[model samples]
Target: MTRLDAVVVGAGPNGLSAAITLARAGLRVQVLESHAQVGGGLSSATLTLPGFVHDYGSAIHPLAAASPAFRTWPLHAFGLDWVQPDAPVVHPLDGGRSVTLERDLYATADGLGADGPAWIRLMKPLLDDWEGLLDDILRPLPRVPGHLLTLARFGIRGLPPADLLGRTLFRTPEARALWAGLAAHSILPLSTPGTSAMTLVLALLAHAVGWPFPRGGAQSLADALRAYLEFLGGEVITGVSVRDARDLPDARVVLVDSSPRVLLDILGERAPTAYREALTSYRYGPGIQKFDYALDGPVPWADSRVGRAATVHVGGTLEEVTASEAHLDSAVSDRPYVLTAQHSLFDPTRAPAGKHTFWAYAHVPGGSAVDVRPQVEAQLERFAPGFRDRVLACTVTTAPQLQAFSPVFHGGDVNGGRGDLWGLLSRPVPTATPYRTPVRSVYLCSSATPPGGGIHGMSGHHAALAALKDLFGVRRGE
Candidate 1:
């Protein structure tokens, strides 16, 4: 048998991304995935009914579309097509009113009414350098930023808690609600510091590149990535789980794109005691109870304008969203902030003719098994009247189920680990290069690394770069 240059465990976005990076550097790389297919979270299935394709994980991918590494790759040539809706987001309120984050900065500002000027003032500067800003933030921190001025400008506004920032900047119910909806994506209490970072980036991405998804489903994006990797001479072997070192092919380096726990298990005693302890002490935030609905028709939203965008934030006022996220450990709220994506509305490939699909989930306590279906449906019904009537079938994925699906979604905290201030800084343990494990030639490239979660794939991109430099003495752009 011949020695391989690198072996990547897990065929998720990050894993495939790592393999692609190494293979691009002219290394022989192979990816191993436990699932029959690639895309750990970027997968799709007929969970509810036949002909109704549903996304098991991410639906709308603003980050993936705008990723630095992804932009450089020719994913579109490999069967990836983006479906950009008219608007990026729509946040519905009571009284059949809603505010939209339109693709155009001026148009979105106009929709915010009196808060229009404030909205422009807050977002325009960041949007001007969205690409530079994304490059700086989508990697490990505590390093020299590529865009110093842009990062500093963002830090001023994004350092505060979302609750405080939203209330302070926007006065109108519509604008504040829109800001709250964006911030709630963090899956953290609106009062948490650094919560505004994702909020700013999401809003910026909305204007820079409309929040888009693959035309067929999330799996198409994954397939395109895998296809591109194979084009670079990388091999992907699915249905193979790497439990320990012996499970991996003999390689000069191995990058584990699973959770920190999974990495530790694979390394066993090869990992230093201190490193093991750090990973063990790593914390996870709230999990989510996901609901996928194979609907008979489009969601009958009260305002009707909600159909303009594929993504909808269905939780009323800023106060409501803040409360919903704040009470993660307690009883579920009747008006929980439900992040929903209706891909079938724009992409006919997602559902059978005339029918549609609804993807949604609400934050919950980590590892929670409580059935919050009634509460989740109630929230849906509140904004979109007769929502229950359109449900042909519903598939509820509990927090534990998400963890089982992908260990990176540990306890269903889909952002991989947590996104709080400390969680972001000390992800899987604070280090100059979190991707580098103590064991030589082994690295952690999962979302548990810096710039945690989302489908951006920067974690894997950065990790592979680290390995390329350390093992092959290959640097970026070298």
Candidate 2:
């Protein structure tokens, strides 16, 4: 057999990306996955009923669409087609009203009424040079940023708590509610310092590249990535688990796309005490209890405009959304904030004709086993009256179940680890190169590394570049 140059463990987006990077550098590479399929969070399945395709993890792909690494690749040629909705997001309010984040910046701002100018003033500068902003933010921090001025501008606005920024920037309830919903994606409290960072990114991506998903399902994106990897001469082997160093193939370097704890287990005694301690101390944020529904018909949303967007923020008002996320550690709220996506509305392939699929989830305490279906459905019914009547089938996935499916989602924290200020800076361990471990030939390439979470695959891309430069003396563009 030909000698392998690199081995990437776990066939998540990161793993596949690492393999593709190595193979592109003219090195032989292989990927191992425990699951039968790739796309750790990007995978889809028939969770509810036949012909109803529900995304197991992420439902929307604003980040994936705008990812610098992904944009440069030919995923489109390998069956990756984006399904963009008329609007990127719709935040429903009381009294049958809704606000939308449109693909056109002015349209979205115009809908905000009194807060229109504030909205443009806040986003226009960053949106103007979004490509440069993404390039600097999507990698490790504390380095010489390619766009120093842009990074500095983002930091000044993003360092404040989302709640503070939302109140201080926008006066209207519509704008404040929209900002709160976007900030809540962090899975951290809206009041948490640095929560505004993700809020800004998500909103910017809406205008930069309307929130989209693959034409068929998120799995199509993964399948396309795998196909592209094969085209690059890299191989992927599923149903293979790499538990420890002994299980890894003979290769010059290994990139791990699992959690920090899993990485420690793989390293065993080879990792020094200090490094092991750092990995052990890594903290995870709140988990989520997700729901997938096979509906008999479209959700009868109170405001008809809500149907225009695939992504819906179901929690009302800034105060309501803030309270819902604020008490995650104590108890699940009776009216919890729900992040919902109605994919069948835009993609016919998601369900049988006239039928629809609903993907929604609410943040719960870490490793929570409690079922929050009642609360989730109540939120849905609150916004979309008669919504319960349309449900053909429902599949509930608890937080623990999510962790069981993939170790990367440790304690069901989808972003991998906490995304707070400290969490982002010291992810796994504070270092110039978080992907590089104490072992020279081994590296960590999961969301546990820099640019934590979301499906961009920059974690894997940066890790592969590191290994390429160190092990093969191959830098990017070589």
Residue 245 miss distance in model 1 (angstroms): 0.9
Model 1 clash tally, residue pairs: 0
Report RMSD (Å) for each prediction in the order shown: 1.0, 1.0
How does model 1 fare in lDDT? 0.92
RMSD of 1: 1.0
Q: What's model 1's TM-score?
A: 0.99
lDDT of 2 by residue, 42-73 (tens): 99999988999999999999999998888899
- Candidate 1, pairs of clashing residues: none
Using all chains and alpha carbons, the TM-scores for the candidates as numbered come to 0.99, 0.99
Please provide the root mean square deviation of candidate 2 (C-alpha atoms, Å): 1.0
lDDT of 2 at 356: 97
> Candidate 2 clashing pairs?
none
Runs of candidate 2 exceeding 4 Å displacement: none
